[model samples]
Target: MSPDTRIHRARVLALSLGGLMALAVAVYMTLGAVGSWSFVLSYRGEKLLTILLVAWAVPVSTVLFHVISRNQILTPSIMGFDALFMLIQTLAVFLIGAATVTQWPPVLVFLGELTAMVAFSTLLFRWLFGRIAQSLELLLLVGIIFGVLFRSVAGLLQRLIDPGEFLVLQDRLFASFSGADPQVLAMSAALVAAASLWAIWRLPAIDAMILGRDGALAVGVPHRRMTAEVFLIVTLLVAAATALVGPITFFGLLVANLAYRLLPGAPLRLTLPLAGLLGALLLVGAQVVLERVLGFTGTVGMVIEFLGGLLFILLLIERAR
Candidate 1:
């Protein structure tokens, strides 16, 4: 296909995804409303904002992570990022107790969580990528090991935690759209915006990096530096989203891979935006179905994880073939 034709197709796909996302948002905001328009909009607006921010952050982070790792199946969540976040939250509750943690300002908690996540990512990447010069396979293996270790520690702490505190910790661990604090949502929006700007500026480097390390280097891209920069941005985006909504293990993988399939030959500029839009569409659409059709019987996060897990296994089987 001609380059222009590919670009035109990508544009059409993006518009379609964006239009669907807008429709979902409208339906979510307006459907089944019983109160004053102003009150309903103000209340639903916060939840909608949280969903959009998370949708934008998760898929963008996942795509950048896949580019840096050069693996479609790899995600930050798979690399122990979400496990580490859960461990951090669990440890906080274990050490400080749930009451105090809950009493702490949401902004303070968000900053602390973000700081811990970024610090952890920096240390892990430095050791794996910088000091050892690990291959991608080895990096993934080590990440799996770390993920197991983090989960084990979290489990042990939860076992010892007071049951009430454990309940609080459990609540924080699951992804919840309705439970998002407005203050945390505001902070997350700022962080995601900044990360998006950084990503926009690095689109050329990202496209080059998609060609793999040696290929990117051959094409005059600073492979190591670009990888580090991309990892940093991914860490920030993941941290912000995870902090706001809790851990979402497979949602990013699902959205990123779907975006890849939907825009097969598109460049990073097109693919990234499409991925974000698709993420929003999936999330908001799922929430709409859960609330409107299912009568909120279960959380949207669980539904996403269920479907994403199936997709993850299918991708693995496909990869093996």
Candidate 2:
């Protein structure tokens, strides 16, 4: 396709996705309401904002990860990022007792969790991503292997903890699409926004990183430092998203793969915004339909995961052939 044609297509797709998202938001807020207008909007507005934040952060994180890891099928969750987060949370609860931890200030607890994640992931993922950058199948296999390994280790730790404590851990381990605390939501928004702006400004550097480690450095792109920054942004976004709504395992994979699939050979500038729009639309649209039309609440996470997993499997089969 010609440059002008591609640009026109991208614009059309963006507008379609934006329109769908706006429709979903309207449906979610105003449909079937029975209480005070202020109460209804205030309550649902927070949830909508949280969904939009995840929509932006998860796709950005996944796309940057794919750039560094050079694998679209491998997502932060599949690459054991979620498992690592869970392991850290599990270890903390085991060490400090869930009851005591619950009483601690939310900000302190949140910062501690965020700090530990960034520190650990910076060291571990930098090496792991480097190793898997060249082989797509190997990258996928390694991600699932490490994801299972981390989940197993965390599972062992969780089992050893008190049964009562398991209840607390249970909530943290599963993904939830609703009920994000306002304070945590604010912090996540700030971090995601800052990371996104930095990324857009440094788009040329980021696109260079896509050339692989040696190639990027040959182009004077500071590959090592750029890789670290990418890891930091990915970890921060994934960690924040997981903390907000637990871990939505395949959402990032689903969103990023669809963006690349739809806009093959497109620049990050084009694909990233499309991914964000698709993510928010799939998620929020799912919520509106599930809650309003189907009358099933709290299962948006489940529905999206089911669809995402099917897409992942299909991608694997098609790519393997």
Candidate 3:
């Protein structure tokens, strides 16, 4: 289909996503009044914000990542982002006592994480792409391998830490989405906004990049620089989400594949926006179903991951045939 047709279809998809979001908001409002409006609203509001942030952060990064790499299966999480995040937290506890690490203000911790992720991504891309001409599949394989290395290293370090420190590490790793500092939320929103604006400026280039290396280079696009910039952005976005809500694997894989399948006729202009909206809708809808219908089971992420993994497999098989 032509770009115009894709854009029109994307507009239609956007309308659908907007409708679902509106529905979710209405449901929340009705349920919000069902209990103590003050207490329940305050508590649920934090969760809603986390869901929105993760929703925006993950799919955008993943989609742009695929565009840069020219591969649908490549995701930001596959690049050792979550593993690096966990490694940092584990190393912090191991280096400093658990109390000291835990007592360090969250803002400082956030900054430290942001810095480390930027550095790691810089090194990762510089090395990975700097080598001789490589395929997107090769990049994906390397990323997955590096992610495993990071996870193994982090796990081994965790074993060496004292049991008490391990307890603290576990808390940092698996906390509920119940509380988030308002200040941190504001900072995170600002970062996402800035990155998004940059993304908008680079959108045309991204569309070009999706055509692969030679195609982009032929069109006067600097593929290497764009890849590096996108890698940095993806890492930053993933780190922000991890810092916000611990690592929830497969969320991006699920949503991005769904968006692609459902919106083949949608261009980047429409696909990116619709994908973000669908992500928010899925997460918020799941939160509502889990809390209200399921009586607050602590396995929303696990359930979503399970379903998403299955979806990923089905999509792969469909693509193969």
Candidate 4:
């Protein structure tokens, strides 16, 4: 068979296998008898939603960022997103003591963070992309610089805060799937659905966008306006996921690259669904193995982050060689 045919067959096989594995994991998570199955399922469902939300949001946003930037190495979170998110969290806890912060409803905090992140992206994009000659590389560098600035400010605030507040800030920074809140899940799902609908409506335009800036613009595509819309969509996604489950920094890199390697010839339509499916499978399976099989009570975020980091290094090496 030809190379493309072989690749297509392999991706079809992978998708089938991944889907079955995900189903098995879901069953495993729900099959426990030691605890009240009802209680276990409720908590597990919360975590499942968290994993699924992040699974959907991160890879999609990362893919969009890669397409717009024309660089596989860049993602929305690469642009100081994690730092900005942490800064917001730190500022909140610092300003309102740990006890009070913890007492505040998670839903309110989530909405607030969502508003802040969207506003931040809107302002940044408006100012940066307003100039016709600005390069993505330049924009990326500025993002990194701004991220450093946010981190520095957050660090200073942490140092000045009460010791108890610092402890709360530190605790808040860890990524934890087990602590998923249902209210956050509802909000995240709504936003992701909206973004997905928007993506569907603009499918043809995104296909053209992959042709790079000048090429798309040459073909009469409103490249700048489309990119700005994409950036806003991606920012909303990243913000919701981060605010809900904390930062799964490298998860997008892992899943997106795996999708590229596993998809039926890297077409966005097939690749998007397959990537999302694989991502959900990976997280659900990981959670089951960690919690049920191994009897470990640790968070899923740590495991994904570790594996994702390793995959990232492998990608860098492969690219280098």
- Local distance difference test scores for all models: 0.89, 0.81, 0.79, 0.79
TM-score of each: 0.95, 0.88, 0.89, 0.90
Structure candidate 3, residue pairs in collision: none
Please list the residue runs of candidate 1 whose C-alpha ends up more than 4 Å from where it truly belongs after superposition: 134-136
For residues 243-264, could you state the per-residue lDDT of candidate 1 as single tens digits? 8989888999999999888778
Compared with the true structure, what per-residue lDDT tens digits does model 3 show for residues 1-321? 787777777778788789989899668646736667787677677778877888898888888887876667667878887888889999989888798997888788877887887787777666666774445556667778988998999999999999988998987786245577777777887888888888888888878887788898999989878877777777778878877777877888888878888878455777778778988998888877877788876656777778878877877887799
Per-residue lDDT tens digits for candidate 4, residues 172-230, read 88777766567778888999889877876877787678988888888888987888778
Give lDDT: candidate 4, residue 176.
Answer: 71
Error in Å for residue 269 of model 2: 0.8
RMSD of each: 1.5, 3.2, 2.6, 2.5
Instruction: Give residue 137's lDDT in candidate 3 (0 to 100).
Output: 58
Higher-ranked by lDDT: 2 or 3? 2
lDDT of 1: 0.89
Predicted model with the maximum TM-score: 1
Off by over 4 Å in 4: 1-11, 14-18
Once superposed on the true structure, which residue ranges of model 3 sit more than 4 Å away at CA?
1-5, 29-40, 131-141, 162-167, 319-321
Better TM-score candidate (1, 3):
1
Rank order (by lDDT, best first): 1, 2, 3, 4
C-alpha positional error of residue 35 in candidate 4 after TM-score superposition, expressed in Å: 5.0
lDDT at residue 8 of model 1 (Cα atoms): 89
Clashing pairs in 4: none
